[model samples]
Target chain A: MAMTEMRKDDDTALDLFFAEARQSAPEPSAVFLGRILAQAEGVQAGFCATPVQPAVRRGVRAGGLGMLLALLGGWGGIGGMATAAVAGVWIGFAGSDTVAQVAGYAMTTETATASALLADGDILALAAE
Target chain B: MALDALDDVSDETLLVLYGNGDRAAARMLTLRMGPLAFRVAQRMLGDRAEAEDLAQEALLRLWKIAPEWRTGEAKVTTWLYRVVTNLATDRLRRRRGIGLDEAPELPDGAASAVEQMIDGDRAAALEAALAQLPARQRQAVVLRHLEGLSNPEISAAMEIGVEAVESLTARGKRALAAILAGRREELGYGHD
Candidate 1:
């Protein structure tokens, strides 16, 4: 009985405290909603910008194409050098039919200059050394 | 119709409606819950302007979350109350270095017709007593007493155990009593 009574008293005290505290609290002004709506509108605007994804994809594709072209150019340069080397061998060995036919099978025009450049001196100097 | 007519509509339903760009639900939820948020913030901060700002910020956050608000995880009002409480606690801690003498008095009640029943000095004294309590204690007390949140709800909002909520409220009320005890005679609160 005593414990129950004590609990009741505690409840009463708590209630009285609430009643007092509630008196001091005020209602929020109307402008708060307007401000919230404005923020929401701004967020909506940002979401509207989502269509830019396609442009981003286009940029990625452009970058991929550029990389592919660079790789092709590098391999083309290497192929040209191999062709020129074989061509030089073909022309230099024309007196021997076996060597001439073997050279012809391997050589192209661009390879000859590259082969000369590699065999020759000052043109191939290292930059730092 | 009374505002309670819309209580049949669940908070989740209103959130969904608001998500679908129904502005009416936004207005309704703000109208219904804004006062509670403001009251909680005001009690915690003891400053009208700062409390208003915190309440507005909390509402804005709610608006931002309306698009993806998952229901049943937490009550909407509870979340707003917690956000406002946390914001008010931050502002209170930041302003702690300042002297209390210069702290602006809350708007005098007697100046307005509705608030004429309240005695300004007594109200001011109570607010001062509230200021003496630690931020957590004050928040626990306000959420329980001023905002009428249950112990479990207060625990969820405050991110504390129910026992901690109990302890904080008990200590807070005791401290408040001690502080207000001096002004009891002046405020006519000691008598029936």
Candidate 2:
């Protein structure tokens, strides 16, 4: 048919155009290629500069002390616990008399005055009345 | 590995090596894929400068993805083609109001004077007609005929169904045939 032949001719014409287009495909300039390569190198360098570190595993394998520390919330918790232990040990070594003296010094003025009154027999007179 | 030594190496292997911090692999991939990305971008966007920028951006994306590139998965060329076409489409969308007359002429820089005159005329004529097509048609035609991508490959690149790709290419070729029918003799194809 004439229509079929005409279609075939059109296909051939289009094919030639496509071939010419392919032959004349635009190429990147050397400078453009260089810039791309440099960017690649830079990106690769970034990966090298910041290697991913393995995650730190936790739990019993960290040892009993470490586990306790972790449970108590790390170094900050350990500091608070150490301070309390040291205070307890100091109080035990200081004896009850020393503790009483320190407690007396820490008492309010009203309590101190009441203690003085009891020591001076004021409490005994009030008791007789 | 040396650059030449990577001649037999697959793109996936090159990407893996690049991921492992091999500079030579990076160079090899750049050498091999950069032109492909550029050519596609150039055909999609008729401006040399815009095409160059788009190509660079696409390849930069490739570099960033190199570390996470999974071997034995998608081909690198397929990924690059998708990136270039998508980016070019976005740019074309932004230039919606611009007329076809505003498109900068593609340069004829590679050939000698006489050869350049003849081939450049044919290339320019085809490119001008290509620019007249709807964005999707131009993309389909360029990828199929010019880039020689198969329907399945173009389907993947354009993220469309294979049947849709077939339809677009068929329509595109017909449109191109009509556009260029008047110029066959001038382009040395002789009158129909």
Candidate 3:
């Protein structure tokens, strides 16, 4: 029992020291606090100053022609459609006789032109007048 | 937010505000946590300059982490305590060869007015004894006794179980008592 009391006494003594230590806890200098605050401000400034770049909405906003090209499967598809259109115009203007001539069949352009002029005699009359 | 309005704000709230780039919150958090970080660093490292450096580094990390700080996930003080202890432990490990006799002398201006109010000799004696302890024991004892952190808080700060904290503190107190036994009369604790 006496030994336990002695231990208690030692504990009490240590507690006093601990108390003193707490009371005497160090205070950081103003310079130290200022430095910390400065660092915080610098970091906060970094957060504010950086701008979040808006995502570039590429290809979707291209106007009417761009939309049309896109609908036609872009440049490659548009090029194919353009070629088909040119060929159709050529076939419509040159007629079947011209196509047959190009295929090495004997055909005259004058005969085809004369027949077209006869079918549209009003155009020939207008030219004569 | 106004600086005056932040007086009643919680640390986590202040951190969130600081994350949002609120200058008032930054000031408030620095004022609240800077001294705490320094005090614990000083206790653990026993050098004012070194303590200030460690405390600054810890607070810098806190600022850097502000944007990602998850409120309600952990207490701010607990995190700071853990960081300061870890940094001090790393420093102590690197300083393994340095003897206690080589401990830096306290500068003449190092003692503050509050330190003067206490028995400076007693505080010094206690500090010397604390310096003699193993790093973990000293950390446990200082946090438990001097800093008044509860076992669970110490456990969180030290990243150990509560039972382990209790064991460390018990052992630390016994060791401190043994180290300071001969100095009781010198420290005017002879009557006790």
Task: State the lDDT at B41 in candidate 1.
Answer: 78
> Which docking class does model 1 fall in?
acceptable
TM-score of chain B of 1: 0.81
How much TM-score does chain B earn in each model? 0.81, 0.85, 0.87
Question: By descending lDDT, how would the candidates be arranged?
Answer: 3, 2, 1
Residue by residue across B30-124, what tens digits does model 1's lDDT show?
A: 66667777778777887888877788788777777877888789888788878888888778767776433333332232122222325645555
> Docking category for candidate 3?
medium
Highest DockQ among the candidates is held by which one? 2
Candidate 1 per-residue lDDT over residues A29-116, each given as its tens digit: 6686566556655654454354554344432345666676566575676688789999888777675787766667677655666666
The segments of candidate 2 whose C-alpha lies over 4 angstroms from its true place after superposition are A50-116, A119-129, B98-120
Clashes counted in candidate 1 amount to: 7
Q: What digit string (tens of lDDT, one per residue) describes model 2 on residues B1-192? A: 788899999999999999889999999998999999999998989999999999999999999998898877789999999999889877886776654334333223212222333443888878877776667778899999999999999999899999999998888787777767667766788753
What are the clashing pairs of model 3? none
Q: Is candidate 1 or candidate 3 better by lDDT?
A: 3
Ranking by DockQ: 2, 3, 1
What tens-digit string does per-residue lDDT give for candidate 2 at A1-129? 498887898899889889988999999999999999999999999998966866667543355887887799988988999999999999999898999988878786667677676755776776689
Deviation (Å) of A13 in candidate 2: 1.3
